[model samples]
Target: MSGIGVLREGPLHAAVKDLLARPGDVTEVKYGRYVIDLVRADGELVEVQTGGFSPLGPKLDALLDEHRMRIVHPVPAQRRIIRVDANGEVLSSRRSPLKGEVWDVFDRLVSFPSLLAHPNLTVEVLLCAEDHIRAPEAGRSRSGRRRRDPGERRLTEVVGSEVLASPADCAALLPDALRAEPFTTRELATAVGCRMILAQRIAYCLRGMEVLTDAGKRGRAPLHVIAA
Candidate 1:
């Protein structure tokens, strides 16, 4: 098994520990500001950085400067590093070129939801490209034909018919008081649980039949009231 596969075997906590344990020039500290994952190497702070720009970046920079140490931020392989000077002016950046199985593992293993929900960690997923990855297919049945139960079919048909028939039935059942009162296309639609466009068409038909009349415009939308 690859290193990435081994890393993926355990829970997130163990996976993160394994990532930090990789032989490097730096020694990782388990916790830092707000108990987030932090590492130290040769007195410099090392952080695995993901997501986009936010206040946390500046705050971490400030903390590192306060401790008189430099920071090494390992960003995702596809992302570009952003550098801000002492005055917060963007200095320079280069697109990260390192791509491998381990990088993919790192991307998936990181719990973005947990990080975003953290009270102290204000990490937010912005402009993520991972949605482009296609979903895996589930195993297919041996026989190609799909089978449907009769009860399920009847239930589905009933639900579909009700959804299709409700609006027309509701319009037919409109109270005499409401039908007599002046209403807009939208108001009538709201009362009948139908689309405004459909309501307008119905009102137009009713007007031609002398059962409804256009009561002029309410703002840009048309209004209709019952005709005597």
Candidate 2:
């Protein structure tokens, strides 16, 4: 783990790290008690997290006070499922119907929403396509069927990206109406045209970033207003 992280990570994580790294960036350097993914020549810290952000709380707390930190998160906008045989030959390939949206980052952000309060912290969401590789294995599923679990995820292409570095940046994700008016999570959901759960996460992050303020309650739901 002390060596280059790319060497130990999966195909997709390694690829994304390589894509985000610039010349002169040091990969997998130790800082304090944490093993950071990389440190830029400019002394900035970059972490490429391929999954949940929950585990990053300690790292952010330990580093954000002294160093500029950038978190790189990949959201699979599209996925191609590839079934490979024992010989590693492609058995089949198909595009999944489920699509990923940039807003989906909030799902993971829900855990450390308040971390955005740090001026030195920045979250960069990568919208990309990936290949999901799976191979048959001798096992049983929870329901007693043959095991068919998700395997590796390999980066195919980066489609786009968005950066949330400040309150204004996060505000831009909300609908104009919700951005300016006091609203509940349910109202935010309808206004943004997203589900209530997503709206709740969006609201949670906004409040943590100080972009929104407590406005008492409307019915059983807590209402929030944009910070002036």
The candidate scoring highest on lDDT is 2
Q: Cα lDDT of all candidates, in order?
A: 0.37, 0.85
Q: Give the CA lDDT, 0 to 100, for residue 8 in model 2.
A: 72
Residue by residue across 41-138, what tens digits does model 1's lDDT show? 43434333332223345545445444422212222224334444456455565454542211121132132212222222222111221111112222
TM-score of each: 0.25, 0.86
Which stretch of 10 consecutive residues in model 2 shows the poorest summed lDDT?
1-10
Report clashes for each candidate as comma-separated counts.
2, 0
Per-residue error (Å), model 1, residue 43: 99
- Residue 67, candidate 2: alpha-carbon lDDT: 94
Error of 1 at 105 (Å): 56
lDDT of 1: 0.37
